[model samples]
Target: MARVGRYDSRTIDKIYTHVTKKMDDNILDLLDNL
Candidate 1:
């Protein structure tokens, strides 16, 4: 496998996806708690 380079779109996309999922999960939990 190739090593990831800086500013790679794929890496950025992966980070964005992980963060979005975390945010979505948190929001759902908050709504459930309310």
Candidate 2:
């Protein structure tokens, strides 16, 4: 159970980072367009 939890946490962290980066990229694109 601990291992599973650790894996889940890592996966979630990576996903969060990826999402934030994508969001940042999107914002930059919008700013450029504007």
Candidate 3:
């Protein structure tokens, strides 16, 4: 159970990081367009 929980958390962290990185890129693109 502990191992599964740890793996799930790691996956969530990776997904979060990826989403945030994409958001940052979008924001940069918007700024460039302005």
Candidate 4:
């Protein structure tokens, strides 16, 4: 059970990182457009 919980948290961290990176890209694109 502990292993499963650790795996889940790791997965969530990866997803969070991906989402933040995408957001940063979008912000940069918007700034370039202006």
Top TM-score model: 1
Question: Compared with the true structure, what per-residue lDDT tens digits does model 2 show for residues 1-33?
Answer: 365564777687888899999999999999999
Relative to the true structure, candidate 4 has a C-alpha RMSD (angstroms) of 4.0
lDDT value for model 4: 0.86
- For candidate 1, write residues 1-34 as lDDT tens digits: 1455666777788899999999999999999999
Regions of candidate 2 where Cα sits further than 4 Å from its true position: 1-7
Residue pair clashes in candidate 2: none
Over 4 Å off, model 1: 1-5
Model 2 CA lDDT for position 5: 63
| Model 3, CA-based lDDT | 0.87
Candidate 3 lDDT by residue in tens digits, 1-34: 3655657776888888999999999999999999
C-alpha lDDT values of all predictions: 0.86, 0.86, 0.87, 0.86
Better of 3 and 4 by TM-score: 3
Looking at candidate 1, what is the lDDT of residue 15? 90
